[model samples]
Target chain A: MSTSRLARGRAGTSWPRSELPEFSPRELVDEINAGVEQGLRVVAYFGAAEGSDIRLFLVLADDAQSEIAIGTARVEGKAFPSIAEACPQVQLFEREIVEQWELEAIGHPWSKPVRRGRSLLGAAPSASGSSPHLPAVTDFYRVEGAEVHEVGVGPVHASVIEPGHFRFQCHGETVFHLEIALGYQHRGIERALATGPDRRSLHYAETAAGDTTIGHATAYCEVVEALAGARVPARGAVLRGIMLELERLANHVGDLGALAGDVGFLPTASYCGRIRGDYLNLTAELCGSRFGRGFIRPGGCGFDVEATLREQLVERLERAFVDTRSAVELLWGSSSVMERFEATGVVPKQIAKDLGLKGPAARASGLTRDARHDHPSGIYRFHQIPVSSADTGDVFARAYVRWLEIQRSVAFLRDQLATLPDGAVRSTVGPLPEDALAVTLVEGWRGEICHVALTDPQGHFARYKIVDPSFHNWSAVAWTLRGGQISDFPLCNKSFNLSYCGHDL
Target chain B: MLDLFLARLHQKHRTLAFPGGPPPVLPERYRGLPVINEGRCEEGCTACAEACPTEAVLLSPRLGIDLGRCLFCSDCVEACPTDALSFGGDFRQAARNRDDLVVDEERAIRLATALDKKSRRLFGRSLKLRQVSAGGCNGCESDVNVLSTLVWDIGRFGINIVASPRHADGLIITGPVTENMRLALEKTYAAVAPPKIVIAVGACAISGGPFVGHPEAHDGAGSVVPVDLYVPGCPPHPLTILDGLLRLLGRIEEEPGKRAR
Candidate 1:
């Protein structure tokens, strides 16, 4: 069932241009379908335009073998027989490719606009008629029954969030189906990256997902550095690891608080929320920006932890953890919080595996998968964090998994800070090698952030693709809501806290 | 119940004493405005402008920087060999008119032009704003969210972010206003009760920040609606956002006594 022609590689390394086996559009579908049937998950399937033609790249993540298989295909026409019909995981990726390249995935049911904007195959795109850039304006999946009713919320939600639409087909309080309409936050980031790696490109990466700023930025930097064949100093790698873990700590703490707030658990909500800021402030102390925007630059970090700063960070971390432990412990102690969380929004393990769910969401569903553990690079390669998972795929499990991860990340940071390798923070970056493809996977706080960069014959970036953890987990959010009450939607959403722009980009 | 009460008591008030109390401690790395010393620039040097990813810096034009369009990534400052540019602690980066956002050392962004007498009467006491994120990256959205947290507690000043435009006296917007969300932003602006204020927060909303001139983006909030106030930064610090709101309300205390570097 496995394709013998695909080339296998680890994350953060570049493959030669000719190494990946190219197949006809038909062979591509056959290989992906066969691979899925044989239990291999299609981690990322994306398209990059090659002059007048479109080229497809597939990343088949084989968890059992602990290896990632890379393959390629050349499209012959405006449409191809849908592979998504056999493998449900490629459904959104196919939709994205169709919208991006103006190519149709024929016979793929639920074909709709994903990240809708200008078409790449030039004007007069086929899918959305003359103007192909309308978001949340497409045909929605409808349910027909006497009691079936639809509730449409967002693109502009009640809370301060990035814009995205959520349509739920509900039978009274119980939600039968939840269809998410995104692309409202799409700013053409991928299109902008085609001619990047300039000074501006890094800044774009830094804020690609905002909250996952370090995640996306590090992935982008790793790709550039890999292509450039530059190795960051030991101290630099250590600092990157610390910042990454700190970012994870900040977001996890914030999410825990937000989850509590969703259930009206005020003590943990208030305390954790405040502690979240304290963690962010700690990051701010590392770099100037609280969100770590300029912190994770290429080659190394923008800011280094000196002796005094190191002491300050350790002290602040201790204080924040003290508050975090007590605040999060409240969630476990409260019966009301536990009752609201335990069984609400349960996503079975089979659903997670079939859908290719990732990050903490996948871990919560009893899948012991983490990029830091499976595909280690930099500091993670030297010092590994144990994978945390739970058997019950529910709101409680998701929250519980996050708490477990937060503790590990905090401990990881304390250890890293205590024994920071002494060396120069910044290293000189070399030029990129000609005709290379770099695929990097960073275990961002959300889950896995995969960035692929294909360089032209001249070593300049020709095509760049980013697969945020949110891209894989957004469908998981829909899966969790299948039998959940409509009122629990907010709780379910907070448990995931997926990024709209991360997926939209 | 006793444990919950004790949990609350142990966590004494965490809010900062900002608009009234002593100014909170800003980190050494916390960037605000660019302090441009034009005289310090090397001869015939466009290095800063060349290094600026967003073209926020212009040398021939009196070394001006349009903070509205600035990512504030500090690449320009870092690239300056002569120490001509350094980030200053002036967190007051709100402007009234679009042109007021462009600053040299001379044109520093201070307080936004106070609202007209009528707006001061209507919303000066208690202002309710509806925030719309057209195509924000969520950095600015999250920072703005922090204002509602116990640390900021912006509600203490009678300034609250309302859920609906109908209940709002103004609209606070983030993002570069992507084409996909242009319709939503316009509709939201039209929905707010009249004599409404529009405050454009972050580099994206002011001038598309990192995404300027992209075909997918409409540039900034001004492209669709008339923006009354523009808060600048990639995502302006929460204090800067608070200072903008307070300034618009004419509640800004005459520049705090001593400025800490």
Candidate 2:
């Protein structure tokens, strides 16, 4: 597998000079198959092109090794073979493609139209028929059983979360099958980008999935940098890595607390909430915004740490680490919390792999596919940050993986602080290149965030596609929720915590 | 069982005591309240006025700021590279009347100076705060989340972000004040029960961010109400936000000179 040749090309820094490897739809598919044959797993595939013809980009990865590739193809004349038949992970992306670009995926078992009645692509549906841009009725799945009813749970939930619908097929208290309906929150972010200025487009990209701002922005910048042939300075790279890890730590803390709360572990939840809030306050102290916004820009960061402030930050983090460790230990020792988390919503290893799961979801299943290590960007390449994984893809494993990651992030932050560099914080990024096509990927707290940027003739953004990790993982969530008791749904859902707005966009 | 007790004992109550002592101020560099630098004014340069997307700045014969209309986007500050405009740490800008919010250039400068002095005096101090999303895009909320994580570690400074407004000494509001969230915003303020400060984080909260002037937009947090400190940016940097919060707490001594420089 190490020597296997899929498609070899040198990774370039910028766009106009970057070689554009134009391949026919069939050739692209063949290349994808070649990569898959060589042990590369297809993580996600999304459609992004103007007019009738839809372009598909496949994100391929390997868990045991660090090799990532983005391959492109055009689905011609309406009929595209379903990868879901071979890789169950493609099902959601295929459904999303059908919903967004109105592409038809043939021979997919569960190829249901997930997001119906919402398409802002064009005008209202004509009197003649439903909009061709919208998914057809045939695209929806039909479940049959006596006295088995389907309960639709959203477009909106009671929580502070974004909108998404959960279709549960329940027989008594047991959930036999689950289907998710999303896209209600689709703000046409990608389409909106195509019409906006390329330089200022990163703002919208940062907000594509609000929580994953840094991740999305990092990915967007990476794509731009690659297409533009710009090199992010070493200091900037380190700062970016620090910011990414900070983002990861903050999210993990918040999610962990929320997960504990989902299981009625109020104390743990409250502690975690308080800890999470403190973490955010620290971010504000360090960078200025609670979310680390504006900290990251195109080529580098917008601000740098002062010597005294950096030392203060380091000491503060150390104190926080000690406190969090003790709190976690207490939570673990609690029988009530352990009982609720363990063995609930278990995702088997085979199922996890077949679904092409990534991030904590895949890591819990023993697939230690971390973007920080796998496709190392910034200072991550230099640092030996450990990847947390477990074979048991259960709620406990998810929580444990997050806990472990938080510790690792703490260590990473310490290393960054110890070797704080004194240099310019930001570097100038030149104008974007015209007729540029590039892909950038970053590992968000949830999973890999991929962005594909296409510049127009006037060097403005022609099309920008963001493939959030939630887009791929939501299906896995539904699959995991199946066969579990209905009461455990919230715990299972909380374990994954897929972003509705992230996926919908 | 023993571990739980020990952990609880070892865990210093991270919540800051506010209203009990002088409010914990902010750091010198913290970005918080807005102050106009009268010295940098080009004797009638309307750059800030022109760049004010929301027309928050009224630089007629007398320079005055309608705090009700001022989003605190800091565009006026950024547009003023001469450093005439700055963020004041004194984020207690709440009032009943629109007229109360209106501050002449001299008062604006003075308020800005007072905040600067107070923040510097209370550096590394703690404050109890409440966060409200007054029709925000959730971006600011996410950033706020990052502020508490291990990397930033805002808790070490004794800052506690409470959930309930009544328990808070200050309010961190992020949003463009969507029509639907208007009541919630007001209720949050009312619930805080006064002697409370308000920190507007993000362009949306400060100046409706990008949603300003949109027919779809519902005036903005500032338009519907008043703000104490305003940290500007589409979403201001987490550090800038921290500075605003710190200033409100009176942890750090503030410098009005920075605003004008």
Candidate 3:
């Protein structure tokens, strides 16, 4: 892995292909073994490319993390050994690939269909109507018992959060296994991006996930910038960073409040909600809209922050920080709240890493991976904010990690404001390169947001694939649910808080 | 137990006296009701009609605003650019009849100027607000949250958002009034014992916003209801929102305040 040729070239180049070692299907496991021995952690396995009808899987190794083009492209027509036998992490991706791309993973036991009837690419049943739809990966978890009935919760919940169905097979209060079925809220955001829209394409991107407008927009801009070979100005980068941090802080505060409310801590919930509201108001003050909408454009921020307004925001944030700290401390001191969160829904560090969880979720599990720190983009490099990490991967640890993140974000904001430079806020980002393939990875509040953009010859988007942090972390949710009591579901769910719409999109 | 008692004392009584005294009014930029620029329309310019996304602005060749379809998006004012199309400062646009809702250009301009003069007479004020979500996408509701946040700090300006309409001096409504939420909106309004102001926050609440005339939808806050103030925009900027709120409190002066540094 250390000697791997992980070079990224501009638009069109085949030179790097010659530098890398090539392997057939039978040698795939051997190659993976070599990489693992050399300290490569496989991040994800993206299914085959559509229309190519070729069996291909993308392997994102640890060493290649810094490299923009990290994933290995494996063609299925060639002989390749299934890594599922060795790496259990590859099992989930392999299952998805089986249903989506219809590629068989040899030696993989849990290769059942995941989406069943909703799968567009899976093989359909014959006219005999013996089987109405193809079986999915969810069917494998069917429990057999006298009174072990399955309780299905949501494609739509009572809350404002997006849709996700959780099939809890429980005997009384204790849960046996929890199976999650998502994709109800998919609005074809990626597909929409593939087909170009005029100027309003970013508007569609903004709505990919309602709560994550800033994160999605920042990632989207990064992809377009990489593709167009455009460099955002220093000031613009700082502004973008501020906006991103603000979004992260607000969401974290709100989640903490909601988690507290779920555990019946009303005072903490109200206080946190009020504090979160304050942050949102600050966002509205800086930008014209709350939720930080329309703040990030292609080349820069939509508006510049005036000095007077910046000072006002700083004062407001100072008050908010004090209030938030008090509220959090109060909640932490409450024995009831602590009892509910302490050891509930623990995700071991090893399991977290193998699953490639990012953001606060991974950080809480002692994985020192932060896109802001590791893959420094925008003003992150300049600010030098310490990446918050904790060893306990429980609900309390996750909440604590977020609290620490809020402090860091406030400090980062002050630092950025102190060194705020004067320059043009925007530059004209011309059309994207035709043959270029660019990938952008950003540390959103939830986790990592990765966007891969490919353009047509006419400078229009040919394919744009957005992998939100939720996509990688949702599998961890099911794992977190295992062995946990039914009462702890909401707490566990809040600990991860993966976006349903984001994953669906 | 001692700490709990102390904590209870530390909690500020989150209640403000309103209506009995002067109501809390927001700042100048708060988006509230559609203030017709009778002066601008008096010149026979139909810029608002042309600029409206949902044709919420109805300016016939002779008459000015058909308040029935008018969404207070401020597009008319933005289109004027001449500073003639000014907000009327009166947010009570609700009416019992469609005819009463109609604003002739000349009458609207006169009313706006008169309201502006009256607001100038009172310098210090406050307003009690009750917010209702008719059929909003929740975007406007989020913005309303910002009003009380550290940045805008609408509370500092004496504007307090009350939980119940009975304790309110004005109604700050957001949404296009979806069919499901119609009853909720009406009930909320009915709960507010009158002399209460109704401030429609977004284009949706005013003229159904983007949801106006949506073939796939039925029911609008305006269709089943009446509005006093119409602040316009998809989600109007918080400043504009503040301005509309202030007008309801009679806090806004005849002229804009000196721009703060």
Candidate 4:
């Protein structure tokens, strides 16, 4: 395994063909375990279907080295050894493999369904002609005792948000354990993307986790562009960079406002809410859609940012940030708000690192990991946004980290727009390269959105694995609830604001 | 508290003065309805249709777009050789029926036909909806949630999204209902108090926008439950969603409706 060398690539660069580090299931598990011991985090571990075999791929992201290592193993039997039992971060990935391929992860601690529903595997179906069992029907981890009681919420929640079931094993107000059951929003996006760099491929990527449209879309376009060997023009890259940062500002500000709203802070909540819309509308000003749909195309962006449009974006960006600054500042100044936000949902640094949390959630937990800063690509490779982190690892830390990011993203957008580059907005992307695996990671507002596309012989996608930051952070949310008051669930949940579709997909 | 008041005072008014005052001002670049110029489309020009990811455009049969199926990406507009298809500045893209969501050259989008005499009378004054995101990507969910924000303030119309289905008069469903969610969606429908309406938000909820034929998903909310209103955008603008809800309640007069800020 030590002799098996691994090379690193930027976020969008393509690998014509990756030689997987040779290892059997057991050996591969041991290698990953060794990598973890050396501070290498698992970025993505997905099962790719090959000619009659499920080739499992694992990406080890070494933050210290600023490099990514790839490894793979072909499943030899119905049951593969579970790496999750040793490496906690690979737990969700292993579960996803079982659910998708119907193969057994023999020693997985709890081998319940991950987003359980229809099996995407080509393997022969069981006698029932349905999924082995219903989603969330499997036994949840129980805290059996006299005082322990269970509370189940959603698949359909009280508010206007995506669906996911949350079961809290509580002894009085404190949560003993919280088991999250999602897949109520699963639309089989992975299955849809198979054999597709088709028209719908970009569309599916854009809508995969909705709020992170720009993030997922950018990653998707990067993968496609890399496969096609297309390079976006300077102007186009700048515009994409602007849009990405604007998306960050909009979401980070919105999250801050929502965090305020959760705590019943009215003034800041009202103003920040409107200001968030102002940011969204600014996105509307750039490209037709607010959520930045149809913006980042395969070769480049679909729309161009003309001179007048640039001015409008700048004006709105400045005004909105000013308003947002004042409104959000109130949260920090107010003692009551700070009290609610601080120490409510504390995600310890160790737990965050163990769970492989990415984005602001990880940053707040003092992990100091960001895809933009860590795995630079496109404009990020040239100009960088300093990683924001907090030592608190609490609700306030999360909110404050967002506020920090909001300012930095604003500054980045301003800087990019001020020095507008020259060239066509879009480049002509050719057909994807045959039999290649393109892995891209874009820092979505939520966190690292990793997209791995393995093309079949004809250049169509054979297996597309999307690892939303939510997939990594959801378990961390459960961890945050440990010994915390159950009433603080909504506030804590909003603090993380993990995407359900991103996870469910 | 005084400082907070001062900050808000300086922030000025952000809410739109619409319907009663004037329609909400969408950005110039904002895409809305597909304004089809039949004359501009040259014969045998299937460029727009070919370019459309979801096949929202049909040139050979007719020059029209199925808004329900549209990702609203404006790719067709960009792809069209002529001015046959263009994304206009109309935020009112929601419709009452599946068929109505289809906009041909005529550009007619059917509004929610004012419920019924009894139903309208019951819900018109005040409507409470329980949003069920069956398989939502959360793009629509984000916009839907925006309606409750200060900018949209859907509460002004006496409309509120309550916590419980029992308290809800209608269910606002998003996402293309996945197979796993089908049972939960049905269960949600069953739980909602009778005389309830189901408003499908976003193209996903109306027609499974992107994941239409995916095996794990039943295309849109219509497959699992009857949809009363169809708001069609990849994720409809907050204004569009508000307009659909208002039209369902028969609140909008001519222009986009307004609230007394």
Candidate 5:
């Protein structure tokens, strides 16, 4: 039995690598499973290869206590007992570890490569037949029956969206299972980030999931700032919060519009498409880029808001929110939209809990999980956005929860921007402390975005693991499609709007 | 239904008057083409080149920049000690050839030329393109998708993004062309009928933008297929994308003195 207590940590903070509790592979599995049974959720579980062995790291979040427990287990061989069977949250993480390292998760059910075949640490094992391992080429769960058939959608979809493949096991119009195969968009971001926080690292974080650029970049910056022990100015912290909420407003509005489009409701659909750009334009108005690139950095914000620009931003934000309110108000007025939305895609609260879904998705399922509320950091500590939730766990609930958040975020931005803090926006960040591990969690529009960085002795990145919200909720998306109408796939998908690149990365 | 009509009316006709009217006024902070003041540079200073994440800045024979690889980030402009390079709002950043993507102090970007007369006749009035995001971060994909919204209303120009490659007259490719998506992109390109063209949108599709030099990525679309036009920007603005499409279709002429600021 491992008696050493796990190294306690707070989100968006750094701890020395030497301080982590060490456990055997079996002890690690048992400890994590016991924690999961006691209501802790797994935030990140990854491996960093050391010679022939692997150093497995785990980050478990206790939302009730606002604490994170990090521990490492040394796996001497290629095989370790799977924790996925007991704690379903690490199911994908275990599979990824197995693929990235050559370590096998013994007794893990349905182990498969998460991304296109290649080991993150070194060269992949050569296959028996000719040709190397192909991405999205794997055994899919099959339903055998006379009437059961399969329909496959592309790595190149009809719409102008990121590439991913989807296989639906169908019995005529009813879907038995939906397995999403991604990694067509893998750009080797994690591998590139290892060994340095070079100039290109921020760009990688900014584009990790381009739509969640602010969310991911803030997480990246927070982790770096934590590692270097840098404190951002009050003004910069407020600006980051404003940008994050604006991002939320943009995506939530866009999703509302997209949901309308999927339901064939044209008014809200058309209005939202432009309104989404309007919110994005506000970010563009602050920073040069519409996506908020080059805005957030390690020390603080790259740009600042003057009194004049602040007034202009306030005016534009007011107008955009008004338009957004009018446009979104129509979605609820129409019975046709409501009927289509109310019961379309339902994920039970228990299932959502078991899956460890985050952000609005979990909130829609009656789970009161929000990083801002649970693990408050930076400006979020000073200002609080009340967690908005819905109990239905359907398309309507998801959409409604977004609407609630939209209103809340608009209010928050209005209040925060008016009481702008006067201070220098940026500070010089010192060199990172040698041999540190930092974890950051952000409440992105889709869900929780977790970024874990482990530095070597020289303070360069040894392993940079990014766990996008889509990684957790993609399974929920699949669950939503179970016994669902195949035609409703597009509608259900719009309801969640999970990112393929975020998951694939 | 009345409420829907009222909401529609409230949303109003928000489309931009571009190419027909004055070019839309972009915000001041918008970073378009980089203007290099060659005189301001120190004798052997390579600050701009060193600051660029994608090696877009070339300091050899004076300062030249590769727009195809530029993310339009503030890094270079901020890093310049002599104030040599500043981003000017000149949104016409599409080029007909890959070589034209690299611009120096003296010359502006060679805006994309129209398709040859025959191909122009084929796709001028009705160019249906199928967009494939090979390894896009969704920035390019989302911006391209914005073109079809009421604000841009790209279909008003008789262009649309069709649902199938078979029905498309061309392919608008975005991304760094990851190895996994290369085969699928090729198959989609082949599915299009003859006389089809390929347009690479954003820096990623043109020159791998931020993901440059990654082993999994093929750098750009040109490696897998020929690119007829290169639209520059990390994710080129909707106007930038629209400008490229119209330029290639010969719908809009390249006005010498007109620049959007």
Candidate 6:
């Protein structure tokens, strides 16, 4: 038999559409499953409608080889055999494809609408039915017993958080299963991007997950640059690296603080919260927006750091890091906090691997996988930050991994800012190539953010698929809840700190 | 516990004396209230209007920019051939009326006034708000959350983001108000007791920001519930959101033309 017909490319590079080899639908599913079985990972598996036919595109990352393999398959009818039964990571992608195109994935264990009941190609169902299809109003996995009562949480949450429904099957205080139904925050961003890179495309990317503005923005810009064949200046790349690390610092510190807060450890929680703002203030000082919106553009960075501002940022960053160290160290000292964090919401290594988790969640489970390390792009191609990992897959492991990352990110930022290169911070990017496909992988603070863009003959986007790290990690959140105390949900949730809007988008 | 105490002491009291002595000193790069020099606009120049992603800039009758729709990205300011538009450091940008968000070169924004005396008496001393992020990116949600941190210490003002809508006097909303969240948002507002005020935060919650004209979103919160105050930004700075909240409670007087320290 012949080997899988997959064309290979590096992250943040573009290839002609003709270069992608096409296979029969069954052959393509077999090839993807075969690749996953041999230790390859699925980056993006989505369907795009071309003319009257629905085409399925698969992007698999060979992390060990540091190369991405792309292939396409055309579905003849409304259904295709499920590859998710062999490769679990493509489960969500398959569901999303089903939701968007109304295609069926036969033999898939769980078949349900991934987003709201509103189809991508059709309007929402009218409310005339006895039980109308709506966002997050679906049947959940039930644990049937006299004592197996279910708890249905909100699309309207308790805190100032994004909307999502969380249903838990509980026996006394222990949870048997957790089913998360998201899609409340969806604004049809993907559908809106088909004719984009116009004016609002970059804005959509920046707000893909508001907390991950820099991450998604960088991914989007890299995709544009790849299609346009624009090379970002060295200085621009370094500045982005600084901003990205700064973003990571802010979020990780905030997560630690939130984790502490969830465990009722007030000292670390109070300090880390204030210190997190300090990090965000540094980003605001560089770019006008606290979230770094409008700072990252297609060709390069929107803002440049001058010598004086660089010095000021360095000073503030140092001050914030010092405060952060003091605050985060308090968590380890308080045995009560440690006791709560250890062995709670433990997602074992095998489960994390099976689920293809990314970022610190996977790292905490001893996966040792980071896109920056595995598939380096932009500044990461030159200045490499070491992957921070922990062996124990518990809440403590997650927090410890973040702390480790915080230390490394601070050091990385300090070094990058000190050696700030001198050049133009931005360059003009021209029109994208006609009939091309581009994929860019960015190691966002949360995890790997993958953006795949397929351009039409007019150089406009034909299909744009954004695979947020949350899209992969949300299922892990469910796995963490299995056989754990129901009350530890908040702590487990804060430890992952997945983006709801990112997933919804 | 000894170590915890020592760490807490080392952290020190970091709260700012905002709305008391002076406002926080924002960075020089911080884009606040946009300034439009309509005189600098050349005849038939549509650069600023076309450059805007949300069509926030209106160039027909007069050169006006809508803060509700603006992303504070300065794309229009940069696109202006003659520098007709710029953002000043004055961060007081929130307003009560929807039309007040549209600022021309002539008149400034009509800032949000305090609630009626009876409503103020009901919520001023103690205000509990339920935050509903209709379709918000976490940007607005995070910034609003920043108020409760020690630096902001919103609790000092007797304001809290309560858990239940039943306990809330109002709803603090973010997002472009997507269709999926419309029912929940309406139900949330309905669940709150009568005489409830809804403060829409962020450009998304105010005018749908960049997501404007997208069929999936309802433009903003006003399309559903009547918003009492509009806090504007891509995600308004924590100060911007707090200022809007304070103004509604009659805690802080409007400091017109006052730039940040």
Clashing pairs in model 5, backbone N/Cα/C closer than 3 A? none
Residue-wise C-alpha lDDT for candidate 6, range B1-261, written one tens digit per residue: 778777878899889888776888999999999888899878899999899999999986899989999999988988888998999998888888999999998879888888889999999889999999989999999999999999999999899999999999999999999888888898999999988999999999998888898777889999999999999998999998888888888887767323222
Best first by lDDT, ranked: 6, 5, 1, 4, 2, 3
Error of 6 at B2 (Å): 2.3
TM-score of chain B of each: 0.95, 0.54, 0.57, 0.93, 0.96, 0.96
- Docking quality tier of candidate 2? incorrect
lDDT of 2: 0.65
Which lDDT value does model 4 have at A132? Answer: 37
lDDT of 2 by residue, A1-505 (tens): 4443333332223334134444565565565666666657665566666565677766566544565555566677776777567656667767777766666777777766654423324543332222342222133344678988767664324433444557788888888888776644444456656755532366666666667777887887787777667778888888888778777887798788788788787656657776765565566666555566556777887677888878878887887778678767666788889898898889888787777777999999888777777777777778868889987789999999999999999988988888977777667777778877666658899988877777777777767777788877887888877788888888899899877657655
How many backbone clashes does every candidate have? Answer: 2, 66, 41, 1, 0, 1
**Regions of model 3 farther than 4 Å from truth:** A1-65, A71-140, B1-261
DockQ of each: 0.67, 0.12, 0.06, 0.72, 0.70, 0.73
| Candidate 6 segments exceeding 4 Å error | A122-131, B256-261
Q: Per-residue alpha-carbon lDDT of model 6 for A277-358, expressed as tens digits? A: 9989898999988899989998899999998999999888888988899999988888899999999988889888888899
What tens digits encode model 5's per-residue C-alpha lDDT throughout A13-79? Answer: 8899888889988888887887777788999999996667799999999898888989899987788
DockQ of 6: 0.73
| C-alpha lDDT score of every prediction, in listed order | 0.86, 0.65, 0.63, 0.83, 0.89, 0.90
What is the per-residue lDDT of model 5 for residues B1-261, given as tens digits with 9 covering 90 to 100?
787777767888988888777777787899988898989988888888888999999887769899999999969889999888999988889999998988888877888988888998888888999999988999999999999999999998889999999999989999998877888898999999988899999999998888878778889999988889899998898888888888888877788334322
Cα lDDT of candidate 3 equals: 0.63
Better candidate by lDDT, 4 or 6? 6
Q: For residue B170, what is the lDDT in candidate 6?
A: 93
Q: Is candidate 1 or candidate 3 better by TM-score?
A: 1
State the C-alpha RMSD over the true interface residues for candidate 1, after superposing those residues.
2.2
Q: Which sequence of candidate numbers ranks them by DockQ, best first?
A: 6, 4, 5, 1, 2, 3
Clashes of 1: 2
lDDT of candidate 3 over B144-215, digit per residue (tens):
765664445677767778766677766677666543344445666787776566677665666654445532
Q: Between candidates 4 and 6, which one is better according to TM-score?
A: 6
Judging by lDDT, tell me the better candidate of 2 and 4. Answer: 4
Better of 1 and 4 by lDDT: 1
Error of 6 at A196 (Å): 1.0
- Give the total clashing residue pairs for model 5: 0
Pitting candidate 1 against candidate 2, the one with the higher TM-score is 1
Could you give candidate 3's per-residue lDDT for residues A1-505 as a string of tens digits?
2554444332112122223334454554554555665655544445434455443434443423454323344555622346776776566666656654556777886666543312233343332212333121245477888888778775434333433568888887778898887644433355456655343367546645646778888888877877677788999999999989999888899888878988988776766766786687677676545667667888988778878877887888888887777677776788888998888888999888777787899899998777787667888767678989989899998998998999999999888877788997778787776545566667889877777665655667655666777777887888777877888898899888787657655
